[model samples]
Target: MVDAHRTFVIVGGGLAGAKAAETLRAEGFSGRVILLGDERDHPYERPPLSKGYLSGKEDRDSVFVHETAWYAGADIELHLGQPVTSLDREARAVQLGDGTVVHYDKLLLATGAEPRRLHVPGTDLAGVHHLRRLAHADRLRNVLAALGRDNGHLVIAGAGWIGLEVAAAARGYGAEVTVMEPEPTPLHQVVGPELGQIFTDLHSDHGVRFHFGVRLTEIIGQDGLVLAVRTDDGEEHPAHDVLAAIGAAPRTALAETSGLAMAPRADGGGIAVDASLRTSDPHIFAAGDVANVDHPLLGARLRVEHWANALNSGPAAARAMLGQEVSYDRVPYFFSDQYDLGLEYSGWAPPGSYDQVVIRGDAGKREFIAFWLKDRRVLAGMNVNVWDVTETVQGLIRSGRQIDPDALADPSVPLETLS
Candidate 1:
């Protein structure tokens, strides 16, 4: 058992940061653990922010991973709303926003990520929001609350995870919503065009209008608040608010400024992390949306911004920091509930590796699953309106076996024996 000689300092109090701190105690690290967060709220589940929290089905307390008693009993120092301004690697210390310095033996960076900013005209105007932090969610929730009744409007830019979940929640509250994406199909980048089309149809069935193949040029405002959005197609949309969810870029400026051997990307993208989730410096580790960990099956590095990745992988990094020789070899899994549809997805396919995909069940019936395959091996799979088959398909992907479409598509074939 550790006897308080070593101090484990974790930066950023998001899902990853919280999980990492918990994993240390669970893994038998009894030394001092300090968790610092920029936001005052405890590390809560963010996926719900775009859904239940925004929909008013849940409140702020629902956001926390555990109650207040859990942290106090665990002997963890909880520092809320305290952000690290700089890292002095040479001194093994971190400088806080209020000029307080924190010394540490090992530093785990779960710094998470920030949404890409939209600097177009009227961006500074109120009602133009980016759904990233909990404070932003609270603001949107206030908007919905002030309406006094159901039905408002949400004009969302980018069809990524956050935008869809927000739209789904708003629609649940009887809000008229529209989503605009630059791609013909929003999920095309992840699941390919075929399955993405299925999502388009799913949203359309629920009266959610989609403006495809378009980009937001400007957000028009009235009285310093968003009134509408103008698109590249020379069309203007009158909207109550605008949400920009294009994507997130890693906040690696502090690490980079410290001369921590950061990698360069042509487009200024995600932070690079090895299999152990260690940055260029072995002493400094990273996890969550900010770090680009390698996908074992894909044989390529990827940044999975899903809650599952953060929850599981963060602890794995913490374990490594505690002298445990472990590697992060988990598949990417994420889910979203839109209208009556419960969509689950996993295991991104290798680039251009699949010639065709075999889908099982019907789409409109909302009870179907599709498999992305290459060389008969299940690269990735998604289940829509089907929960029973989740365990079956997930087992197939876990086994990494050869599968026959005829057998899988039949629904009679037990997914367990597909090997």
Candidate 2:
């Protein structure tokens, strides 16, 4: 019942790759499906790595996308712990690290992204960590536990989501936490200053120290173990561990070397693809964090590194691979849990994109919905401690309707009536 002639090869066995393979089978494609991954573990989600898993609230088994046996049962050829060395675009094949060549009729690149490393010295030293992988989380979880027990200090770089979440987790473990950020406010580029102060207040109220407008200059260590970190401002803070949570850069080495088209660095660089997720080569396609897609709804080329993008784009790419008309236009979405404050943000409204930010409900009590509007059109929305309104928020973004700021801000007026 299998068609050996039509083989679909998926590179990078993360959630996107796994979901793409699953989608292929679910869509009745009974051909040869091969998945390759660099890590030994099965495909898993990355969000838990910084949230529940890092905090010791979730077990290791909870991270995997599917059971080990599911791959074989679904007739998916899975190669774990082996990374693809190079892509032969002309030959329609990929070379493995061990010099093995695997030919494919269609190729899907779900290579994902890697954590941006700090350029400062002492990064290679012991107790300096980055939280991008499961292994990294495992190590950081234990380090946090130990630091908590010893009443040690954690020096985190960057005030992004990962940095803020880790700061909260470190505090929960009873470890002293301090965050260093080059930006004036936390998540300045994402939510802008209007709401960045909310997160700053949230973390500060939990006793987390913040050093803004400074970059890490050096990391001082004793016996190769981090002792403290020095900032560009010439301030040295005692640190038992250092976490670089700056950001992630899309893994595009293979795509670049293979001569596939790439998006410009100014446009959030990644492998460039159209709405169908098709690359420069028709035989090859891309999805997830690695693919910079020309979004139909947003009318712009965008690269999203959030969990939702990976969750949805994988299947969309698979459908496209199967020769289906695919238009990936899902509104970008991401959620964060920092202490008692939990928020879900939908749509895209980076700095300079929106003209106004309207808030509904109480900001003092930490319960509010903030909407970013451009030309009176809802561009994005963030609901803090608000429940069951994701559909409405996303609907407003999708509709692209000009909404009254007063009605949008009033809790008395139902959001559904705005549309």
Candidate 3:
């Protein structure tokens, strides 16, 4: 059992860090719990940044993880807008941005990620934005609302979830949007080409143009504001604004500088940890996007950048920190809302890992469950516009039993039968 007197410090005040602090207190740890976040706002949800919040359907306070009173009542010291500068492993101290050193008996690094910035020329121009922080979302939301019911051109670089969702929201605001992707299809790496085409069709049907197999070469500006985007194909697409949604990189500089062992470069470069989320230093643990854990299900070290992982991993880390035996073997899961489609995906199978995809419902109808299988065993499953089946889908992946392809692709055969 962990001594109640030990001070526990948690860095990064995003959902993961907040969840860790909540877990520590809820698990009967009477120790001092301190959460340090660089942002001015308290721990908040990021998923809404692209959906309800960005579209003006939700307000600012709805995004927060908790109200101000919860932290004080929990006896958790909340340090907002204090960026941690360095970690001294031997000294058991963390240096803040203001050069103030704080000591702790145990530390948890839940530092999330930042949107990968575009490197092309003219990226600094006005009206070119990337949605990551609340402030950024607020600005974009204002822009979209100002152009309400009027057609404006929005040039989006990279057709990932953020780009696509923003495109949908812009369309709702009467903006003519165009998305460019280097891949042949959007999100082909995560979901296979077949499933990716469904999204492409959905966007195309709504008049969102696509420039596949193309890269943004430059952002053209007039009077220090974005006017157009130039692609490598020598075509310049005029735009009133631009959004670069390539992807995100984990904030691992603190761990890297502190000499924490990193995962193999192929696993996307995060602090390496075992199934229990324990870092090389037993006193320290890493969770959320900053942690590249060895997953027993995938049988490989994988780094997941999803809200579900962020919410679940911290509690597992807290339990393990308290000397309770724990293994975070939960199947990876994530969801996306694009236009009218609501998608929930469970289990993780990297590209080329799954042999085939079995569809149990019609893709054209936009309501169905698709299963990715390898060696006749389910690897992952996705439900689109379908309700209350995620647990059953996860159960199918965990069962590890050979399943009939015909039955897997038939709606008449219940999922529980396969399990």
Candidate 4:
């Protein structure tokens, strides 16, 4: 039973914060639960912001984690548009932007990350945007629709998941698209060259131009609106709009101010936490993108900014908050929907960590399951357009057993049999 006198406060209004509040209630905690968020809107999922929402296929209300009534029903004090400015661990209180102070018996920092801004010249122009929130996606949708009607060009400054997804969406809206990447191949660092080439081919077949091994130096604008992007190769890509999808940095100001231990800069620079998601102070916990957890599977600390991490880590942090000794050991999982490709990846292995990649299906057709192996043991697996095999793939990695490469590559061989 929870101590009703104790107050549980969650800082953040994202998916992880909402999930943590829900978990506390589900675990029979009747304590005072408060969720504070900086945004005016309620907690919401962000994946569709670049794909379905930007293309106008999904409605705004669909992104929310819960209906507004649910918060009151669960006795959760929903504090929206109130940014927490400082965390006073000694006082056990959090100060809001409006000077409101709330004391908590236990605190969960689910503060998610923010997009890394592009500092190139003219990036502050009107036609340039970054997709991290609903408002950004809505504005981009309008720009895409206008470009679609006028046959305008949309220049994207990164070829990562967000950039590629936005490119696909812009193309669907009839906007001519160009994607620029600093690397030789997009997603090469994550999925390797061979698989990354497949995506390049996919985008190329759809008429999206790519400038590989080039850096975006400036955003050229006319009348304070983005007109083009100039790259290091001295090539100019015409643009009606520009999107910087480079990456994100953790929102760690609150944690830092609270004097919490932080991870190393190379390890994604987040609040350092143990396997139980507890920070230095036993009463305070951290989760989601802001948390650099000592991952059991990786045998090192990792801070994952994907949707799956937020979804799984929230409840685990809540369990730890409720005096339960629980470890957030779920393997990292992420998926992307770009044009015809529905990709699902499970587990984690840094680039160059795996020795061999064995495929079970046709790569040319984009219908395949590829396994990344180290010492003949599965380290990670990705299913491209393959159905209902995620659990099986994750099972293989969890089992940590060596298997014949021939069996891994054979389509008729059941993955369950490999164990």
Residues 1-419 of candidate 3 have per-residue lDDT tens digits of: 33547899999998888998999899999888989999999999898999999877888899998898999989899999999999999999999999999899889999988999899999899888899888889899977765555567888988888999998888888788999999999887888787999989999999899999999999988799878889999999988888989998889999999999999878777889999999999999999988999988778898988989999998898888888998889899999988889999999877989999999988899999998999999999999999899999999999999999999999999988989
Decide which is better by TM-score, 2 or 4: 2
Where model 2 places Cα greater than 4 Å from the true spot, the runs are: none
Model 2 has an lDDT value of 0.95
lDDT of 1 at 367: 82
Error of 2 at 122 (Å): 1.2
Report how far off residue 211 is in candidate 2 (Å): 0.6
The candidate that wins on TM-score is 2
Question: What digit string (tens of lDDT, one per residue) describes model 1 on residues 1-419?
Answer: 34578899999899998999999999888899999998988888888788778888887889888787888788889999888999999888999999999998888888887889887888888888888888899888777554325456779898877778777777766677899999988676777787778778877888789999999999998899777899999999978878888987787777777777554564234667778888777778888877777556557777777899889988998998987887787878888877777888877764386877888888658688888987888878888888866666667777877777788787787666785
C-alpha displacement of 149 in model 1, angstroms? 3.2
Q: What is the TM-score of each candidate against the true structure?
A: 0.94, 0.99, 0.98, 0.98
Give the poorly placed runs of model 4, Cα more than 4 Å off.
Answer: 1-4
All candidates' lDDT scores? 0.81, 0.95, 0.90, 0.91
Q: What is the lDDT of residue 204 in candidate 1?
A: 82
Weakest lDDT window of 10 consecutive positions for candidate 2: 1-10
Q: How many collisions per candidate?
A: 0, 0, 0, 0
Residue 133 lDDT (model 4): 83
Off by over 4 Å in 3: 1-4
